[model samples]
Target: MNVEDAPEGVEEPQILPLDAWHRARGGRMVPFAGYLMPVQYEGIMAEHLWTRESAGLFDVSHMGQLVFTHDGDIATVVRALESVLPGDVAGLGDGRMRYSLLLNEEGGILDDLMVTRRGSEIYMVVNGATKYDDIGHLLDALPDDVTMNLQDEQALLAVQGPKAVDALARLVPGVEALVFMTAGAFDWNGHALWISRSGYTGEDGFEVSIPAEAAAAFADALCAEPEVKPIGLGARDSLRLEAGLPLYGHDLDPETTPVMADLGFALSKRRREAADFAGAQRILAEREAGPAVKRVGLLVTGRQPVREGASVVAEDGAVIGRVTSGGFAPTLGAAIAMAYVPAELAAPGSGVRLVQRGKVHEATVAAMPFVPHRYVRASASPQTPSKAGA
Candidate 1:
């Protein structure tokens, strides 16, 4: 009797604010995230390469944006949220984004999302399709004192790629200074925009939430740039997969707990020791017992890519698990995928067999992110340099 297992029914398809803009640009519309969003504009492979080599614009208006505010201590407000999420929400610095999960009572993940502390409140952005249900869940779970508000007036746009900073810097001077996972409001083209120096693709980029009415103009203005071309859902999926990120329904769901999904790290040590969060006991027990099966990255040895739902077989021909997300990684120029394999066979450097086209394709359990992430980092390792001073 869970929400995800609710009786089969269909709701009328919805459209984003930029639906018209997408069609006018010759985008191929498809159903995704509960909206008739553009699946590809200039084709998937081309758009994927474009995002890596230059810049790509995406109308992520389908994503949900919300703002929350309450009286008194921020810790109290954050604690209420942290009780349900896996991340150390209480320790997040102002304007810093933290990736966490919304958990069910049994510690199963409902969604993964970003939370940014802004001033005396918190700003949150979640997947487009699950936002409404997520909001209601939060409302029902949170204490009465905690308040939540939907930022219905906003629309989201993401500008991502290697040249994302320079491409966006033209509008908001000094934007390049913002480090990864940091966000704040800035003026762009005479309109106030909330720009976050983070994105899904494995590159330096920004996700801007602007006024709904101005979203079209802002998107158009960015698209006018030489390097920025409109990308669609197909590219977005490929990019995130290449970055080793989990898609909602594919990599996460109510049936899979955070520990089983290998996302227990999102739960902070402080929270873990305190054991105050939702489904903490189950999540903690799973962590100790070691999940039977876990999500792992795969490096398919051949050109034939294993698509989702593809069965993974052990050396002895036993069905060990199944691939949850798979595709050709444009950046790596090879097929990559994520699968849930028995813990015994999930180690990196291990070899497995993937069945595609009813034929066995040799694959290795390579570490995630078949491609390297070029995030804007400072004072860390020899790699991952800052965009501004690099």
Candidate 2:
């Protein structure tokens, strides 16, 4: 199931901290986001299901982790961030995190990210492919008082699935207290790490940011657990797809706004009321009057998986939209896809047609998250020993 990198002529991809570990474990390394990442292990199907039933460790070191500081105060920096981001940075409580988007001047999405409030410093994790662009934009958009620190020496690992807590608890105790969307600073093997109970799999999970040198050992520790297995990018994509979460370059881009992408929830209530963020005028207007087109889920009829760039047509064969992401959902055992189409035709059960590679297939508009989200709420009891303490 290993995926290899670029052909002979292309330059070799940059190696991550766990490159050796991945190679030793039969990972299929492929070029992604300027790095060589494991695309699959045993197979995409097995890895995807393993994550749903148990825990899967993923090396996401390619992502960019940033820390923001302000000389005046954290509040000042938070306000400055609000100028470009749509989330209420000032309202974020200690150790709490929120999913947000960086919007362009025209209300289009530049990138999607996870913002966590950590005492004096605000932490952010942006997509690897757009991290540089995002950093450049922030450098120009933020006020002089705010300082952005890019943490390139850190490696990220996601332990995700229903058994994630149990598997992770074996190594780090006291983390069970952290509920969904919450983060905390913890120690593992004498090394400090920031862990958040959030992930893209629509399941209970934790993402840990550790120093690059210690990443391999930390990943090995997590993988040693009986419930944990190393997963790859292939499963990662399928999992997010099943969760109906949009990928940046694919489902979302600079040309799509939050309203158009069906991500209005990311725009905090106060932010919407104030309408003070980037492209507020256009976003707020779209919220009230509605967007012309909307991102929607599609249930592809038959076995073929409709892929990106496929034309979405109306009943009369008029091109109305295009597919952005599509693939076979292991959990659902059916082919599913995402596309942007007219608002009127975005409703569930609406009839549509997908033309891919000259093959036209019938499809039906479906509600997102082809699978139900199983995020663990705060009510779950925390009980596990801390291996690090031992």
Predicted model with the maximum lDDT: 2
Q: Which ten residues in a row have the lowest lDDT in candidate 1?
A: 1-10
- Residues 1-390 of candidate 2 have per-residue lDDT tens digits of 011121233345678999999989999999998789999989999999999999999999888888888763788878888888999888899998888999999999999998889998799999988887888788788887788888878899999988999989889998888888889999998999999988888877899999999998988888889999999999999998888999999999999999999999889999999888889999999999999999999999987899999999877889999999999999999999999999999899998889998889999999987887777657653332111100
How much is the lDDT of residue 365 in candidate 1? 94
Clashing pairs in model 2, backbone N/Cα/C closer than 3 A:
2-28, 3-28
Candidate 2: list runs displaced more than 4 Å: 1-12, 379-390
TM-score of predicted model 1?
0.92
Question: How many angstroms is residue 385 displaced in model 1 relative to the true structure, after the best TM-score fit?
Answer: 9.6
Model 2, residue 360: what's the lDDT? 96
Please provide TM-scores, in order, for all candidate models, with all chains considered together: 0.92, 0.94
Tens-place lDDT per residue, model 1, 1-390, is 012211123376777888898899999898887779999987999999999989999888877776666685677678778867877877888878888889988888888888999878888888877888787788778777766777767788899998888778887787787878888879876778888888888777889988888888877878888879999999999998888888888988888987777776688899889888879898899888998889999999977779998999877878889999998987788999999988988899998888866788988998866677778755443236321100
Candidate 1 residue 14 Cα shift, in angstroms, is 1.5
